[model samples]
Target: MKKTFEVSDRLFELYHRVHRLVNESMTEEGVSLARSKFLFFLSKLGPCRSTDIACALNFAPRTVTEAIDGLERDRLVMRKPDPEDRRAKIVSITETGRVVLEAAEHPRKQLLEEIFSALDDEELDALFDIVGKLVDRTDEIRKRKDEAEEAAQIAIAR
Candidate 1:
């Protein structure tokens, strides 16, 4: 139990360390890591509504709105009235956004490469497997929780 806790603690710390490093490097290049995710999504998906970005990114609507506002202010993205729904707006990445995103990606990729280069082939393979297992277990837990909630809702309805 102690070993398990120690391993998880180290993993958590390592995640934050890497995240901080990546964010710092990207920020120097004019795009914070958090904002890059939104740009990446918009670049791929083209124009979509705030609701869609919220759902796809698993972010709260208000959080998405704030991020979009910042991105728009920076000229990284633009929002226009939805043609189909006057009450809602559609957000899309600007050409400038694409250029900035591409530029920022280089440093992010290079930093990750430099960090991962420390691991040899065997370590890389083992780390990949471990991460895959952890992700699978997390997904399994989420599914079970969702099922349990549905069951509880059904019982309450009766």
Candidate 2:
């Protein structure tokens, strides 16, 4: 008898494959995924502190610093003292960075379009709905985990 597949298993496989493809494709485009994501985030958020970027990306502070250092050396980003927080520095993407980001994103966008082009409008809508539910479920799980941890800590204090 043939084995039935689970949705979670399928989702994990798809996620892994897509992630690997993205990494490989980005490398061929002469940019690391981390750098591309950083540039994209900076573009969206404007100048932000290195710590903020680290928090948003769930990366270590040192790792974020190193990435910013490399971008700074490439002249793709500038580090300036934060106006509101003198001790912290904000990293801002340069015009050159914007150009590079746009170039890198064009191919990625095209690849996504090509991949999804086969799906009819209904299928696309269904996929979106399913993905949204998955996102919500993930968030719920995370919140429950957080609450459990908090409860455990409170019990330990008593």
Candidate 3:
């Protein structure tokens, strides 16, 4: 019997393939996939706290810290104490980071275009719409789970 594949299975495989492609494309910049993502986020959001970065990026705090450390070492980002919260630090992209991010934009766009070149405009639109709905639902579920966990912790503390 011929094995059949589900849409989810295909999507999972495609995700990994795209991820690998991106990572490979980024090699010349000496930026890891994770750090590149963080740089993009910082470029979009401007200065932000590490906690915010972790939450927004859905990355662990340690992961964010490590990425920040690497970026800082590369002079791509800088960390400074938050004025309102002494305990928290704010991270901002450096000039070099901005330059790197700008340089990366075209190639990243090309890579994405190449990967999805098989899909025509209508197919791409439909795929994006369906994926957007799935992403929204996933975010909703995650938010509910986080709220429930927080409530449980509060109840326990009380």
Candidate 4:
């Protein structure tokens, strides 16, 4: 019998390949994939606490902190005290960061186009639909897990 793989196994392989290609392409911008992620998140979220970035990215606190340190050093992001919380610092993207982000987008677009060029429009549409469904399923799973954790905590407290 011919070896067969589950869709999830094939999807994981595809994820690794795409992630490797993206990281390799991002290096041309003089920023690692991780740093680019932090820059983009700061751009979207505006000034926010470092912990918030860590949570949003689902990255370890140390990882986010180290990336932020490099970003701050490169002047792509700046740290300031949060107005609402004196003890917390917020990170915001700088003008340099905006320029870097804009410069990065064109090449990223080209890379994605090259990667996806093998698929026809119909195939691409089907792939998108499946990916969207997977994302929704993951979100649902996360919600259930969160609710279970919260209920457990409440039960323990009582």
Query: Per-residue lDDT for 110 in model 3?
Result: 86
C-alpha lDDT score of every prediction, in listed order? 0.97, 0.86, 0.87, 0.86
Evaluate model 1: give its TM-score.
0.97
- Stretches off by above 4 angstroms in model 3 are 1-5, 143-158
TM-score, candidate 2, is: 0.87
lDDT of 1 by residue, 29-147 (tens): 99999999999999999999999999999999999999999999999999999999999999999999999999899999999999999999999999999999999999999999999
Model 2, span 1-158: residue lDDT tens: 12325766787897778667766676677666679999999999999999999999999999999999999998889999889989999899999988888777767777678778989999999999989988999899999999999999999999
Residue 152, model 4: lDDT of: 100
- Runs of candidate 1 with Cα error greater than 4 angstroms are none
Write one digit per residue (lDDT tens) for candidate 4, span 45-73: 78888999999989999888888888899
Best model number under lDDT: 1
Model 2 worst lDDT run, 10 consecutive residues: 1-10
lDDT of 3 by residue, 1-158 (tens): 23335777888998999988887777555665667889999999999999999999889999889889989999999999999999989999999998887777667778998989999999999999999998999999999999999999999999
* Clash list (residue pairs), candidate 3: none
Instruction: Order the candidate numbers by TM-score, best to worst.
Output: 1, 2, 4, 3
lDDT of 1: 0.97
Q: Candidate 3: deviation at residue 146, Å?
A: 4.8
On a 0 to 1 TM-score scale, where does candidate 3 land against the true structure? 0.82
Comparing 1 and 3 by TM-score, which wins? 1
Q: Write down the TM-score for model 4.
A: 0.86
Between prediction 2 and prediction 3, the one with superior TM-score is: 2
Candidate 3 worst ten-residue window by lDDT: 1-10
